[model samples]
Target chain A: MIRLEDIWRTFVMGDQSLHALQAVTETFAAGEHVAIIGPSGSGKSTLLNILGCLDKPTRGQYFFDGRAIESLDPDELAQLRLNEIGFIFQAFHLVPRLDATANIELPMTLAGVARKERSERARAALESVGLGDRAGHRPAELSGGQKQRVAIARAISMQPRLLLADEPTGNLDTHSGEQILDLLDGLNQEGITLAVVTHDPEVARRAQRVLEMRDGEIVRRISADEVSDANPIFDRGRVGKRP
Target chain B: MKPEDTFGYAVNALIQQPRRAGLSLLGVVIGVVAVIFLTALGEGARLYVTEQFQTLGTDVIVVIPGKTETTGMMPGFTGTPNDLTLDDAEALLRRIPEAILIAPISMGNDTVSYQNKSRQVVVLGSTPAFFELRGIPIARGSGLPEGDIDRGANVAVLGKETAEELFAEENPVGKSIRIGEWRIRVIGVNGPRGTHLGQNLDLVTIVPVATGMRMFNRTSLFRIMIELRPGSDIEAVKEKIEAVILDRHNEVDVTCMTPDAVIESLSAIVGTLTLVLVGIAAISLSVAGIGIMNVMLVAVSERRAEIGLLKAIGATHRQVLLVFLMESLLISTTGALVGLGIGFATIHVVTWMYPAMPAEAPIWAVFSVLALSVVAGVFFGVLPARRAMRLDPIIALSSKG
Candidate 1:
């Protein structure tokens, strides 16, 4: 379970303050699949970073499992992320030098897991992602699709309750992106809460629920079936402009 | 995280960029080698001096005229010090029962000519006990005959080099040679006694003490060398000699020197020299530490992404610090070991080449240098490790450079 109340994140330059997230608030119940869809500079990644406990809001009240996130120290926040939340990034983010199994075992190693148990769980995680045979392959040796699978395996190796993905399929070919989406859908069906941030409508179309954001504020909440008609959300202004 | 695990990770990281690691290691290796080799040389000089003193016999004590006080001037120049005469030497032999043999020494420089070959040599004046007391063996013929110290015997003993220079192929023994205005018979030639404390013992000529006093035209003896009986208390004998001289001259003008005190002071001087050499060598080690610091700083910036990933996964700041610190420590430790190997190998080769030097590093010097290098590693590693520790995971992960 997650909750936010009047969350605001601001960046201060020498002469101006930019509000990345302004008076925003949202929540996702346990085991639900939600997607935060927004164009560049809509603060979607910022929101995902906050949800993963990787960054703190400039102003907000965030509660994860009834515990106030603002009250925890940095190390405690790191511990929570290590054990309760897993992150998958657009770049795969697997350490390039480590093999698939080592990459998968990394978080568990950070958590001080036994070597034998870490190996066993890494193998299982790889198998679940259909990459068991590729456990010994490094990121450089893997295809874009396989690298994403390894990243997914690394995320789930710690068996976190919630998965936070920031542009998870943004770097893949369409076919590989579809396969990654199917894998994520399967994991969500297994009762793992999933939150994905993507500019791609096809990625949002698979989510059980979608929230469309504009100018750092959530503009609408819709079902996955309504994602095709959500183009007007981007067409409001500067649709082709880079942030 | 486990310490060994951290160590393992650090080692793995260093292996990734061996050239950088080796470059830093070179600094420490050179520093350690310089320290070991230089200190060993100082220790070798000390050992050589001690060996030379030991050969002269530890039981010998010399009573030199003039009180050697720290007057900030040449000894005997500040005061009209009494001379050490043959009477004082005889009094020491009479008063101190521990004096088994006493040889009063008088010295001068003269040209000894055998036909046309003439060589300037230091002429030593003493009885036959001087040869026995100094451990100077005879390579040919016999030493100075047993006679009274006051009797001027015309018989002379040639030093090894002195004999070679003056006599050429002819046997100098039983042959007459003129030393200055006095004609003396060559009774013996000394064996090859190498240089001791810079003085060449084999380039000297020995004659009767009275003969040297007359030849050099000196009324007082140069110094009295007293050999003690085995198991004699040297300190007690020295005190008795001083007392006898003070009673006769009514002044403690003569300074008594035991081989132990001479060796102790000489060793202390050499020890200080060794420390100074080591101190100079330690500067290079500090420079090497700076090199390590430079390398670690570069490594921290280069591996920012890896550090961020580790922190994201659950590595604490302390763990990150440990890994970086361990990396530097490993570099210094490897350098120290290699340097020690090279230093000892060089010392071995040196000793093999010159067996008399006995160049070897003291045990404490070896262990302390090791400890110093480790300290340098940790000390220099701190700043870079702290930099790595304080790195923000968000920025580090996002940073492209």
Candidate 2:
């Protein structure tokens, strides 16, 4: 679960301070899949960053799983990211020097997991993403879709309750993007809360709920159940159907 | 995280770019090598000079007619010229209880000729005890005779090199050679004992002290060398000798020197000089430290994305700093180890070229070089690592995109 109250993120440009997010307040329950949709410079990524605990709000209170995010120190916030929150960036952000398995194992490695368990779990995570044969490939050696899958595997490897994806399939082709979305929807069905920020309507349609934003304010909210049959192929998505 | 695993990551990072790593470490390598080699050189020179002083017998003491203000040897500058004669030498042997033997030496550089081959040479005047006191072994015939120091015997002994130069391997004993203004018969040849302290022992010619005194036309002897009985207090004998000579000369004009004191002072002067050289060599290490700092700054700036990525993966600021710091630490320490081996190899090469050069590095020199390299690493590695630690993760990561 996550809660926000009047979150304001400001940026100083030259002599003027520009407010990227102005008095934004929102909340979401556990296991819910939400998509934040906006054009460029609409504060969608900024809101996601605040939710992921990667950055602090300029003037706001953020609560995650009953703990106050503003009260946590930098290291505690980092711990939140390491254990409670999993982030999948648009760029994939796999350490270029590490192989896919090592990339997937990074969060657990930072958590001081033993080498044997880290590798075993990383391999299992890779197998879950259908990357069992590509565990040894580095990011530069993998395709765009494969890289995003590895990033997804890395995010979910530590078994975090909340997954935050900021345009995770933005760099990939449509087929790969659709497959990634299907994978995300399947994880949400298994009761891991998911949030995705996207410019694509197809991605927003797959989320159980969608928030539309412009000019640093959330302007609309919609539910996929209310707009059912928007995409028939994803209607069958669930853990049991995939396995 | 486990330290072993963390450092393993650092090692792989260095290994990924071996050439870059090696080039950055070159300054440390050169610095450590210079430290070892220069210190060895200084130590070697000290040893060589000390060995040369020790070549003359430890039991012997010299009474020179001078007042030396600085070092003990070389008695020219402020000396009050007076008699420290054969009589004074004999008086020490008679009056001092520790006096066992004495040799009064008078020396000059003059021309010697044989079979139209003439060379300018150093002619020494002393009693037969000079050869024994100085450890010059006779290769052929015999050295100067006893009681003949005052006899003014027209007999000469050729150095091995002098004899070979004058006669080309022919036996020079009983042969006549012109020394100064007198024609003397050669009675012996000194063996090859190598040069000592830059003095050419191979070009020496020895005759009776009276002959040398008369030939040089000198009234006072150049120096009086006295030998003490074993285990005798040299200071006591030196006082007595000084008392007798000063009693005669009516002033404290003569400088008394124990052979060991000369050796000690020689090593002390050389040791100080060597320290200066080592200090100079240490400056190069500082320069190398600057080079390491420059390379590390470049590495940190170039790897900003990597730093942000590490922070994103939950690495702390201290951890980011340590990764960059490890890069320099590994470089300097590894360079130091390599330089040590290279330094000793250089010493071997030098020793081979000049056998008289005792090019052995002291144990402390090797250890000091290793410690210095690590210190340089820490000294220069701080700034760049701090810069990396202070980097904003969001800015760093996004900047790369």
Candidate 3:
């Protein structure tokens, strides 16, 4: 579970004070599939970053599993992120020098996992993302879809309690995007809390709860039952169905 | 992290850029070669000169007229423009109790004729004790007798080389040889003393001092070579002799020297020359160290991404620093080994080529070279390694390169 109480984040850009996050309070319990949908500069990514412990809120309290994250040191925060949270970036920030397996095992290695066990777990994760045969291929040698799958494998390698994906399908083709969405859905079904931040309504529709934002503030929250699950596949053939 | 693991990573990183490592090592190689080669040359020259001095016996001292500096061209005569007459020699013999033998040597270049053969040679006039005093011996026939010296006899002892050149297979003893004006009998043939420095001792002829003075008729002075008694320290005897001579001559413008003091002065001059050579060699070493520094800086910049990735994966800043430092150290140490091999090979080749050359690499030179390589590595590596360690991981990961 994650909790935020009156969190405010501001940035100084030349002469102006820009508010990135404005006194927001929110909570997400375990096993929830959530999406924060907003236009650019609406603080959706900022909220996700805060939840993943990548950045700390300027004002107010953030509690992850009932512990105050604002009081933690940089090394402790890194440990929290390593042990309890996994991050997936839109650009897929994988170390280019490492092959897919090494990239997937990176988090485990950082956590001081035994070499043999780290390899075994990384292999299983890659298989889950359907990239078992491409374990030894570097990122440059892989396709866009395969790179995303490798990223997905790396994200889930540590079996973290929460998954934070900041536009996980933004750079992918429609089919690859659908496959990535389906993979997230499958992990959600296995009871891992998943938070996705995206601008696409279709991506938001796949989540069980959708929170829409405008101007650094959440404007609306829609439950899964309130939204129609109409298939957008017939409307846009380019946006294929999840496999 | 554990030291072993850190070392493994450092080794792997160095191997990844073999060309860069090799370039860095070139600096160390040049430094090592300069140190070893220059020092070997210095040591070799010193040994060669020392052995030449040793060939001249250590117990002998030469007393020349005039101060040594003032008598540059006339090293064997006093500056007063008067001969060191036979009376001076006799007076020195009586005054200096430490003097066991005093030889008044008169030398000049002349042609000696035996039958129809004639050759230019250096002729020396001395007493019978000259042979024993100067460590020269007769290899064939006999040396000049005391009677020959006392009676001013017209008798000569031919040097080994002179004997072979004039007489060939025939004995030269009891044969008449023409000096400048008079016919002198060849009483004995001298031994084979071989060449010392550049002077050939075997091409000389020895005659009585009185006969030489009468035949040449141009001597106001002669060189007084004194041999001290056995078991007496040469320095103490030299001081006593100098005091006795100064008292006899009223301490005016006279110069005396022990062979050991001459040798010491020569060694000091050689030692200064060695230092100058080492200084010139150090210039090359400094250039080499600069080359290493430049290459290491380039490596740091090129490996920025790898450094960031390592840091992101839990490597500490200290580990990163240590890795780069170790890479530099490895390169320098390898270069040192190569340079040492080259240095020893050069010494061996030179020794083989010139058997008479006494050049050798001492243990201290080898150790100093090794230590210098290590120091140079650390000195050139620290700057770039520190820069690499201080790089920010977040910005580094964000950069495209």
Q: In order, what is each prediction's RMSD in angstroms?
A: 3.6, 5.2, 6.7
**Two-chain DockQ for model 3:** 0.13
Candidate 1 has a TM-score of: 0.89
Off by over 4 Å in 1: A114-117, A127-137, A229-243, B54-59, B73-80, B109-121, B138-140, B160-173, B177-182, B189-203, B229-236
Runs in model 3 lying further than 4 Å from the true structure:
A1-243, B2-5, B54-60, B68-90, B101-130, B147-192, B195-200, B203-235
lDDT of 2 by residue, A1-243 (tens): 899989998888799887878888999899999998766677787888788877789998998988989899887877778787787877777778889998898788778899999999999999998999998998999999999999899889889899988787778899999889988988899999999987766777888898877767887787754433443322211110000
Binned by DockQ into CAPRI classes (incorrect, acceptable, medium, high), candidate 3 is: incorrect
Model 1's DockQ score:
0.36
lDDT of each: 0.85, 0.81, 0.76
Task: Supply the global lDDT for candidate 3.
Answer: 0.76
Please give the TM-score for the first chain of candidate 1.
Answer: 0.94
Give the alpha carbon lDDT tens digit for every residue of B267-381 in model 3.
8987897778667656666676777778778878877766664554445566678878877777777788999898888889988998876778767878867786788778877
The per-prediction i-RMS, to one decimal, reads 3.9, 6.9, 6.6
Q: What is the lDDT of residue B238 in candidate 2?
A: 80
In angstroms, give how far residue B280 of model 3 lies from its true place: 3.0
How close is every model to the real structure, measured as TM-score? 0.89, 0.89, 0.72
